[model samples]
Target: MGLTLQFIPYLEIEGLSSIGRIRKLLNAVKENKIVLLEGRLRKEEETELIKTTMEEINSEFKGIELAVIYPESQNMAFFRKAKQHFINMLLGDRQGLTIVGPASVVKEIKKDPNKIQLFTTDVKVKAKRPSKKKKNKG
Candidate 1:
């Protein structure tokens, strides 16, 4: 039996300049291995970008799933509200596992039995700072 999984893409849009990144994201979705997409859409273009991505993915992966993390514009909340309806739209009442974070997402995709994968040109940066050197006091 094929395992059902949720593929969430965690993207960071600095400003109104993520159009190229969005296109690359949609292109990745077209590969048909992704079950769901979960990411923060912080710009006005995000909705449209997601719509277009869904359409493209559907064309290839028929019945492709999409779960988005759309935070309220005014409140600046951090994933507090769960849109259960969106999960229903994709998994059809089934509780799917969420592949969060950049590394986890890549690991999940690589482990899928279907073996569908998406490639991107963008690079992910680690948020942690390098360890400081300890001074030797003689």
Candidate 2:
């Protein structure tokens, strides 16, 4: 199966309740699409998402791989860090990226303070064997 990526802007989920956000993200992963959310989920929401995913796991759905990439405030200068905090306080969780994908396709998600690497399973395609024709002996 081909991989699909869905990019969701923060405005798309800005008004959704925590449960609603979780449902939307899970539904996309269930459909085999990797979700690229513009912002990270809250701590409680992240916990709830994992809990809900665990509950919904089945034979067909193996669950999900989630990763978040955000700027490290400690590495920033004090003034910049303070500014970031103020911005976050006013703008909500709009300072980072969130990635969610189905475990069936996504093998692993490696994240560092500044980077993310997504490894996937290669979907093997079967090749058809060519048939040989017999020559007539005259």
Candidate 3:
């Protein structure tokens, strides 16, 4: 089966921010059998919201997987500490994954890529492992 991914953009304080988006996203994940979350949480409140949401989801769907993406340039100490708490709260008994990249990269992806697409004929490709061949002996 293909990997199921749920995208949650960074939280903003304005109306209909990422936190609300996350609640809907999580519900969709539960319904669609999503196994991964590719998104960002910019604020401490966002993190707390995630923890609470995960707990709520877990009560119904135990061992649900979550994959989060964050910026690498963030304060490592703070991220590390928060990550520990996040894991213990949301992922302690469940299998999950996390990825880190530059903030710019995440921002770029979070933006509307259609505005920058060079070609309309671009085709998306799926990742695959290279095949190995046997060597011949002389």
Candidate 4:
């Protein structure tokens, strides 16, 4: 006999709306599965997720937990670093695990090198396609 495991990846859908994605994400969580969310939820979506999770949270199902990754700069320019910081402050950074289940499903989600030493999933930001180029075409 052999143990079986499954991985379900939820990437951005071409025709699916934000609400649709949230609905699917919540549904998957309800099924007690680890979801590798492609992107971070919007501010409103995060709030809704927390609210919905809170309602169903119990002894068996803990709830949703977001594990973010913050990259450390190495010999970076002061102005560039400051600009990056300002941008992050305005539009929150979404660079890590958005686990929405019990600890049994996702025990430790880490991205920092220090945490990775203990063994964990190293999630990185998936590069976004340039949207500015589309405007230029118009």
Q: Which candidate is the best by TM-score?
A: 2
Candidate No. with top lDDT: 2
Candidate 3 at 95: error in angstroms?
24
Off by over 4 Å in 1: 1-16, 35-39, 54-64, 70-138
Ranking by lDDT: 2, 4, 3, 1
Q: Tens digit of lDDT per residue, candidate 2, span 1-138?
A: 678999999888888999999999999999999999998888999999999999999999999999999877777999998888798778778878999999999989999876789999788889887877788889
lDDT of 4 by residue, 1-138 (tens): 221222334345324566676667767765655555643566687787777777877887777544433355556699978887686566544434354543435555555644542222334558897666544554
TM-score per model over all chains: 0.31, 0.89, 0.34, 0.46
- The alpha-carbon deviation from the true structure for residue 6 of candidate 4, after best TM-score superposition, in angstroms, is 6.7
Clashing pairs in 1: 8-38
What is the lDDT of every predicted structure here? 0.41, 0.91, 0.41, 0.55
Residue-level lDDT of model 1, residues 59-80, one tens digit each, is 2343223333333334534443
lDDT of residue 100 for candidate 2? 99
Q: What is the lDDT of residue 95 in candidate 3?
A: 24
lDDT of 2 at 19: 93
